[model samples]
Target: MKGTIHKCLAALVKEEYGEDAWKKCLQSSGFEPERNFALTEDIEEENSINLIVESAKVLDIPLKKLFDQFGVYWCCTYAPKHYSFWYVGMKDAKAFIIKLDEIHGLVGKHFNNAKPPRFLYHWTDKNQKVLKVEYQSNRKLIDLYISLVNGLAIYFKEEIEINKISEHEVELTFDY
Candidate 1:
């Protein structure tokens, strides 16, 4: 996982829960108590999982909600605010959505250690504005992916209908 993901989640926990809760989450997640994660650095997957678990325990919320909400925050707020350069030409949600693989490819080029997820877009129903998204990741984060898609739709203020086709795939329907 990338440090930027962890950093934004940490920020969410701190901003919503409290600074101490975030500190505790970091400590329990096997990261340094006051460590500042670099944006391009690679975070250990195990540590990132630990942080999610610890954050759930501290915030008294289910891990699913945490993951989903973090996904929402990532695309809507954090990425827009801190990583605006990445979205330079990809202003709208659909533009960014379709180019996710390209974006990840670029990130991989700039940061050798980055391991981003693979996104494959398939237009299932061209007339009805239905599209199938294939999210392939070692991490079982279908919920996060769903929320992330919804967040992106919301960012563009698009009314979308999403259906989970499988554990690793989803279908999005909307007006183009």
Candidate 2:
């Protein structure tokens, strides 16, 4: 995982919970307990997962909630700092999501070992308002993917209902 993700997560935790909590989670993950991490640095994936899990336990929230919330924060806040090009002229959630694979490809161009997931978007119903996402990744952070879908809806100012049909698929029905 990118250290920038960890950095943004730390900032989010400090903003929502407290500085002490962030430090504690860092320590629990065998990190240096630094409040700020370099954006270009890379850390072991297991450490990042450990940090999230430990943070959830300390915050008394479900692990899924933490993952979902982090996804929102990452998309709405963190990515803007490093990849604002992807957000430019994005007028809708579906359009934003459809570009994910391309965006990850772009990221991989700059960042080695990007290892971003593959997202296939298809319409489950002919109405076109219903969208299904096929998420495939070794990390398998499905909750984050689900929350990212919801967060994009919020970003595009759309009211949408999301249903997680399984570990690898999500169905979304946009009310707009």
Candidate 3:
């Protein structure tokens, strides 16, 4: 799975960088600002994979974890092979991620590890829910979320569809 490590990219310049700095660097790097996160014109060659792998290394984000977090497929102008970059939303995923980590310190601890379990403990409208996800080694967190919702549908005996996925999380609605 291919994904960009924004923190690593931000660290490419300075220490103690804030949100604006991150956006600036990404923008300067030719990354287009999507609604939530930024998107860069990806080049689809072997080098793309190399870049993602190297970024993961620089960020100290375990390769396995990187794969787990953003292994989704994407199309880039440079490469037609259908490669991957970090899948973020219209919002800054990092900020909410930091908050999630704060709320569930365990998430950060496990996320930093390569072999962390595929489980997300979060609040659904103030109610706690446990999500057991599959080994989406190369998919976006949103994709994983969609898959989780699919699974939950079966568990709850209801039908649902995912409307949007933000950097913080995904939005889902059920139709009766």
Candidate 4:
């Protein structure tokens, strides 16, 4: 996992739940409250999961809700501000979703031991309005991925209907 994830999670927590709540989450997760994760640093997967789990407990929110909130915040707020170059000329959610694998590949090259999730795209309808996205990753963060897709819909002002095909696949029907 990249420290950028941790940094974004921290930012989301602090902004929505206040500094004290974030500190409590950190301490409960067995981390120093003042610990700062560098954007390019590689964070241990266990630590990342622990932080998220602890944050949900500390914030009194369900794990799914936390993931949902974080996904939206990352897509619409954090990433746009910090990685604006990635969004250059992106006209819609579909374009951005299709470019995810390429973007991850490019981003992985800049980090040490980066293993970002990869996406496989398939157009399921003749009209090209339906998409089936296969998420290939060992981490199995499918719920987060789904929420991120929802966030992309919000970001592009598009309505989407998502159906989970399996643990690793989702079929998206776009209403454009």
* Candidate 3 stretches greater than 4 Å from native: 1-107, 110-139, 165-169
User: What value of lDDT does candidate 3 attain over all alpha carbons?
Assistant: 0.37
**Model 2 ranges with Cα > 4 A deviation:** none
> For every model shown, what is its TM-score relative to the native structure?
0.90, 0.90, 0.25, 0.97
Error of 2 at 94 (Å): 1.5
Clashing pairs in 1: none
Local distance difference test values of all predictions, in order: 0.81, 0.80, 0.37, 0.91
Give the winner by lDDT: 4
Model 1, 1-176: lDDT tens per residue?
78888889878888888898888888876778798877878778888777888888878898878877787788779988997787677656667778888887788788877777788888877474778888888887777888887778777778778899899998888777
Superior candidate under TM-score, 3 versus 4 = 4
lDDT of 3 by residue, 139-158 (tens): 24444345434433443355
lDDT of 1 at 166: 94
List ranges where model 4 is wrong by over 4 Å. Answer: none
Clashes per candidate (backbone, < 3 Å): 0, 0, 9, 0
Which candidate model has the greater lDDT, 1 or 2? 1
Estimate, for each residue in 1-176, the C-alpha lDDT of model 4 and write its tens digit. 88888899999999999999999999999889899888888778898889998899999999999999998999999999989998999999988999999988887787778899999999977888999999999988988999998889899989989899998999999875
Q: Compose the digit string of candidate 2's lDDT tens values, residues 41-83.
A: 7878888778878888878899878877787787777787677
